[model samples]
Target chain A: MVDIVIPPLGEVEEVRVVRWLHEVGDEVQAGEAVAEVECEKTTFVIEAPVGGRLFAILVPEGRVAAPGEVIGKIAERAGGR
Target chain B: MREVFWIPLGRVGYREVLERQRRLHELRRLNKVPDLVLSLEHNPVITLGRSADPRHILADPLALEAAGVEVVTVERGGDVTYHGPGQLVLYPILNLRGWQRSIKWYIRALEEVMLKVAASYGIQAKRVPSRPGIWVGNEKLGAVGVYVRGWITMHGLALNVDLVPDGFRWIVPCGIHGAGTTSIATLVGREISMAEVSARVRAAFAEVFGVQVRVRDPTGLEVMAR
Candidate 1:
């Protein structure tokens, strides 16, 4: 399993999730943007670290997230369907 | 030093330049082109951002229309703001990963560029707490509104050189009340040429970002867009 967390965004410790590009159970490729977050009036996209199926979304749109906080999880393989 | 193209498009309409930025952004994302700093003056227009409140526009539609001011909603961050001739707008299409991957750092670097430009004219510009623009005491000297996707940036800062008073009077600048806008010409009590301000901005950007700014003809950018 791979965790999707907000990357360190220089001096800003918190960001609000603007939206998710993929829903849970959707497949996402490595480096593909899976979510958008806003920090200090600037919007940034959060990309998936590894290609996999989006397994869970812990933080939904409009919720604030901190750097290093896991906002979602990706399952690396389709297991047992 | 890392190099960035500085393309000056003198006196362009807001929508046309916006289309240009979008095209450059796509090229940059695909790693086809280097970072660019597009400097230009916009025809009179008021633009609102994603979090903008329409009520911030105090002027009625008919009055704005009579003044030839067009209201546009954009994808950048921040509230309503005005753009017109004599305002130098610099849209730096950059991949943040090349500099620092922090939006906060990028915005501060932009403000640093303007603060240095203002300082060259003996004006003290600063950033207010919780406010995201370059301010001279209570009045705004420059405004910043940016949109970043995939760590690539578009839409950028604008420094007021010699502003048209009527354009700003149409809205609460940046949706902030009480505070007004001021220009380099107004603060210095003399007409500062846009060319002079543009030069200062170019030098300041190079100094602040530690990049070699190569002034390029806008025609080359057209070739790149093709």
Candidate 2:
């Protein structure tokens, strides 16, 4: 489970989280971006499709997301999440 | 001159529709979309077919993203697919070595744009003369994974416009595992709306390249929306 969406014209009419790269146990790696959205104009960094360990965020930090909205999740090092 | 821009990108998100088709293949290597760039994505991706074999993408890739969907590793060849939200991803990034780079005539002009959008719902599609896309009674609605790079052609074709035939029952599309992948509201029964099959595939991609389609909005075209 690795989201962090809002792409397509992803100029973010809303996107304001900016932290939590890996914690719940930390491992994340596949592509790694974890979380760093800001869509209002630009600030993207949302990676980590698989490397595992981050648990969840749903939308922590500053708040204000929505576009393809997903925010966070990545707990799969030996498999998926 | 020769415009057919329609980037409605409504449900995009498959890694930003593969990064806007790699930024329109660098705007068709700097020609800046106009030679062609009609798009209409519907995110929910899972692509993996270059004659796929990634162990049959047997899911459980974390249950396919805990069902959020977005597991792309594309090059557009064909073997795995699942472009959700009513599926309709087209990306004629154009330049088939001057229209002769021929990936089988660009997949028979994407099987004549699904045989004229399944004959405008009258249903009667064809082009299985060896297969690539477009079919009717024999199922296989639309699906034509592509990719060229030097010949220039980014991923295009996937008109199961409004899919849900059990969401293609989990991969095996173009690789045809046990046959099944039909659409156009299930072979013309009803309910068609991917902007009416993307205006019948922008008039069948300008009538199979005979050319003459000048709609707008490739981001508000201004010399091909550069």
Candidate 3:
């Protein structure tokens, strides 16, 4: 499984998961924005690292998350969706 | 010198300007346009940033509608804030790829611009530690919220020029309760033209961001060539 972590937002102590763009069991492509997070001054879209099914969401909308926290996971795909 | 294009929309509605910003941002991301600073006044409106708490909007919906104030939820960061005539709203559409990639640096730079503008007007505006806006004593003088997609920015800072602070009671400005708001007019004890403040703000922004801002009319010859 590929971990979808909140990348470091410089000097931002924490960010809130604004929303999940995709749901668990949804097919996601590499570099697709799976979730949205907001720091103090900016909103960022967290992208998937690999193409697969969004396996789980560890953070939900409005929940605060820290840098490097894995907010989601994508299961490796064996074949076509 | 690095350049930022300046587009002035005299008095615009929030939704219209936001759509324009998104379109401009897409063009900027594709390298179709240079960095842009859009300066304008907004009709009375309350905007909620991406992570904004809805409770901060204290105005009743029916009353707000009757007052012609529209509340919109936007994609920028921060909480809730107000905008209207006499408030200069600046949306800097910037691509941070070659510029500063750190959001913190970008935001601080924006505050510096506002602080300098306030200083020029002889208002003692300063940054409160851990808070992301310009304040005078206990009152907020400016608010900032930004959105960056693929390192390109939109929805920048707003500086209170001559706007009445009473309207801000409709919301907890930036979600900070009891955070009184102030303006250049109130501090200076006189009315200042929006054009005057706009000019000063443009200069401060150019200086702080280290860019030569070329003022452009959307349909002017200079911009048409671009």
Candidate 4:
């Protein structure tokens, strides 16, 4: 399992998860945007860290998340499956 | 010094410039191009952002159509706002990885750029807490709204220079009720050319962002967009 952590957003400590593009069990590719977060009237896309199935979504839409927070998880397949 | 391409697109339609911004955004995201600053005046339009309240648009469809104003819903943050001739709009398509990654910092930087430009004209502008725009007392002088996908910014600040009253009469101007909008020409009590304000904007942008701006012809970029 790989943790989908929110990246450091400069001096902003908190961001609200505006929406999730993918749902649990959805296959996601690394570098693909999976969630959108907004802070101070600026919206930013949070991309996937690795290619895998979206295992969980800990942060729902309109929920606030902090930098380095585990917002979701990805389940990596074995043997490149 | 980091170099940024500054493209001055003289009067353009709102949708046309938006499409061009998207194209440049993709190139910047893929590392095919460096950061770019697109400056232009939009032909009368009202843009509603993601969290915009439709009721803020006071103008009815017939009235808007009669005035030749187009309404568009954009994928940026903030509420409803107007753009038209004489309002200098700056769309800086920049990757946050090369600058500060925080959206708060980025917005502040944009506000600073506007403030600097206003100051150049001897007009004092400020940011009101909880009211994300450049204001003179209670009257707004400039507005800032942005969309950052993959940390590459789009849809940026708009400074009222010699604003046409019709556009603002139709909307609440960023949803701020009762607070009127002012312009550089209004404050100075004289006519100000778009070229004069555009030059100020470029200087302030370069100073605030700490990047060397190189003005480029929009011909090549328009061809690429095609």
lDDT of each: 0.88, 0.65, 0.86, 0.87
Off by over 4 Å in 2: A1-81, B1-24, B28-53, B57-91, B94-112, B117-123, B126-138, B144-153, B158-171, B174-177, B180-203, B207-226
Off by over 4 Å in 1: A21-32, A48-57, A73-81
Instruction: Give the top-scoring candidate (DockQ).
Output: 4
Docking level of model 4: medium
Best by lDDT, which number?
1
Model 4 misplaced regions, further than 4 Å: A78-81, B221-226
TM-score of each candidate structure, all chains considered together: 0.89, 0.32, 0.91, 0.91
The alpha-carbon lDDT assigned to residue B99 of candidate 3 equals 73
For the record, the alpha-carbon RMSD of candidate 4 to the native fold, in angstroms, is 2.3
**Clashing pairs in model 2, backbone N/Cα/C closer than 3 A:** A29-A51, A32-A48, A33-A47, A33-A48, B49-B78, B49-B79, B50-B78
Rank all candidate structures by their lDDT, best first, as comma-separated numbers.
Answer: 1, 4, 3, 2
Docking class of 1: medium
Q: Residue-wise lDDT of candidate 3 within B78-137, one digit each (tens)?
A: 888999989998999898775776788888999999999999988879988868889999
Higher-lDDT candidate of 1 and 2? 1
- B11-88, model 4: which lDDT tens digit per residue? 999999988888888887777777889999999999998667899999898989998899999878777999999899
lDDT of 1: 0.88
**Sort order, DockQ high to low:** 4, 3, 1, 2
After superposition of all CA atoms, the RMSD between model 2 and the true structure is 15.6
